[model samples]
Target: MAERPRVWVSQPLFADIVGRLGEHFEVSATETVVQHAPDAVAAALREADGALVTLNDAIGAAQVAGAGRLRAIANVGVGYNNLDLPALSAAGILATNTPDVLTETTADFGFALMMATARRITEAERWLREGHWRQWSFESLLGGDIHGATLGILGMGRIGRGIARRASGFGMRVLYHNRSRLPEAVEREHAAQYVGFEALFERADHLVLVLPYAPEHHHLVDAVALARLRPHATLTNIARGGLIDEDALADALGAGRLAAAGLDVFEGEPAINPRLLALRNVVLTPHIASGSLATRRAMVALAVDNLIAALGYGPDAGRPPSPLNADALTHARKRGA
Candidate 1:
C-alpha cells in the first residue's frame, strides 16, 4: 500500500474536523494551541508533505527551501499575509487560504464595532465604571447618529459588499471606492454609488476600511487622509493592521479631527499604540473579527480540506477549494515534479 500523506497542523484546532483528516492522512497536531515560530514550522515541514496553519504561523521561502517534501500550506484565515506567496511559489509549493467562511462573521463584527464607536459605547462604559456617571445630561456623552447617514466603504470586495448590503437596511446612502469601480449593474443592484477615493473621504458620514493589506496599501489611511474626513466622521477598520497609521489615527481621534474609530487589527498586533489606548473615542478589540466559534471552526475545517486536497489524499484530494496561487497548479501538473 502507498504511504499516507503526512500533515503537521501548527496549532490545536477542532478535534473532530482534524480527526477527519487523520482518517485519510497521517496527522500531527501540536498538543497546545499556540503560534509556532517560523523556525519551528520550517522544522516540522522538513518531514511533512503539507501543513495547516493559522495567521500566526509565518511560512516563508527559507522554510520552504528546507521543506523538500512540502507541497502545500493551508492557511486557516482569509488573510494570507502570514504566508509568503512568492517564496512558496519559488519552491513549487501550493498555498491556499480560507476566505468565504469568515466573510459574514467578520462583517457582523465590523458593523457592531462601527455602532459601538459611533455610540461611544466603550468610552461611556469606562466612564461609568470609573464613577464618572453621576448625573444624566443630554449633552454629556453626545455622539453622531447613524440613521440617514452616508456610509462610505473602501474596497468593494465580498466583505465590503456585505457592509453595503447592511447599510441599505440602515437607510444609509452607500458609497464605495475600489481599484476600479464596481460594475454599474452591481451598484444598481446594491443601491450603491461608485465614487473616487477623494469623494469617499469627503462625503462618508461613517467610513469603513475593508481593503486587503498589500505593500502599496501600507498606511493607506495616513495623516493627510484623516484630514480629508469631517470631524463628525467615524472610522471602522476590520481589515489588516498597517492599513492605518496607528499614531496618526490616535492623533486624529485625540484632537477631534475625527469623531471616533473602531479598530480590530493594528499595525503591530497584540501590542497597540499606547496613544490609542489613552483615547476615549476609540473602540478596541483583540483581532477576532472572524472569531465566532462556528466560523472559526469552519475556517479550520476548510483549511484542513485544502491541505488534504493539495497533498493528493482524502475525499477531495487534489481539489483545493480556494487556491491562492492557481498558477502553481498548472506548474505542478506540467513539471510533474
Candidate 2:
C-alpha cells in the first residue's frame, strides 16, 4: 500500500476540526499555540507533505525550496501576505486561505471597534475601574458620535462591504477607496460611494481600515496621511498593523491631532508599540477580530477541508477554497502519474 501523505498543523486549533485531517492524512498538530521559529517551520515542512498554518506561521521560498514533499498549505485566515505567493508559485506549492468564512465576523468587529474608539467606551471603562467615577461629570468623557458621521473605508472587499452595509443603519455617509471601484450594483447594495484615497482621509468623521496587507503598502497611512485627517476624526484598524506608522499615530494622538484609535492588529503583534500602550485615548485589543467561537471553528474546519482537498484526499479534491497555484496541483498529479 502507498504511504499516507503527512500533514502538519502549525498551531493548536479546534481538536475535533483538526481530527478531520487525520482521516485523510497522517496529522501532526502542535499541542499549544507556538510562535514557530523559521528553522522549526522549515524542519516540519521537510518531513510533511502539506501544512496547516495561520498568519503567524510565514512560509516563503527560502522555507519551501527544500521542502520536496510539501505540495499544499492551508492558511486559517483570509489574508495570505504571510505566504509569499511569488515564492510559492516559483516552487509550485499550492496554498489556500479561508476567506469568506471570517468576513462577516471581522466586519462586525471592525464596526464595533469604530464605535468603541469614537465613543471612548474602553477609555471610560478604565477610568471607572480605577474608581474615577467620582470625577465623572456631563463633560468629563465627551466623545464623538457615530451617528450622522461620514465613515470612510480604506478597502472595499467583502469585509469592507459588510461594514458599509452596517453603516447605513447609523445613517453614516459611506465613502470608500479601493484598488478598483466596485460595480454600480455592489456600490448601491452597500450604499458606499467611491472616493479618491486622499478625499477619504480628508472627509471622514470616522475612518476604518480594512485594506489587505502587501509589501508596497507598509506604513501606507503615514504622518502625511494622518495629517490629512480632521482633528476630531477617529481611526479604527481591523486590518494589518503595518498599515499605520505607530510613531506617527502616537504623535498624532498625543498632540490631539487625531481623536483616538482602535487597533485590533499591530505591526509587531504580540508585542505592540510602546507608544500605543501608554495612550489612554487609544483602544488596543490582541488580534482577535475573527475570534468569535463559531467563526474561528468554521475557519479551522475550512482550512482542514482545504488541506484535505489540496492533498487530493477529500470529496472536493482539485478544487480548494481558492484556486491557488493550480500549476502546483498539476505538477503533483504528473509526478503521481
Which candidate leads in TM-score? 2
What RMSD does each model have against the real structure? 1.4, 1.5
Tens digits of per-residue lDDT for model 1, 1-337: 9988788888888898888788777888898977667687778999988888888788888777788778889999998888888878767789999999899888888888998989999989998999987786878899888889999999989999888888888899999999988888989878999888989999999999999999999999999999999999999999998899889998898898999999999988778899988888899999989989999989988988888788887677778988998776665666464
Model 2 global lDDT (CA atoms, 0 to 1): 0.91
Per-residue error (Å), model 1, residue 141 = 0.8
Residue 258 lDDT, candidate 1, scale 0-100: 97
TM-score of 2: 0.97
Find the 10 residues in a row with the least total lDDT in model 1: 328-337
Model 1 misplaced stretches (Cα beyond 4 Å): 333-337
Candidate 2 residue-wise lDDT, 265-298, digit = tens: 9999889999899999999999999999999999
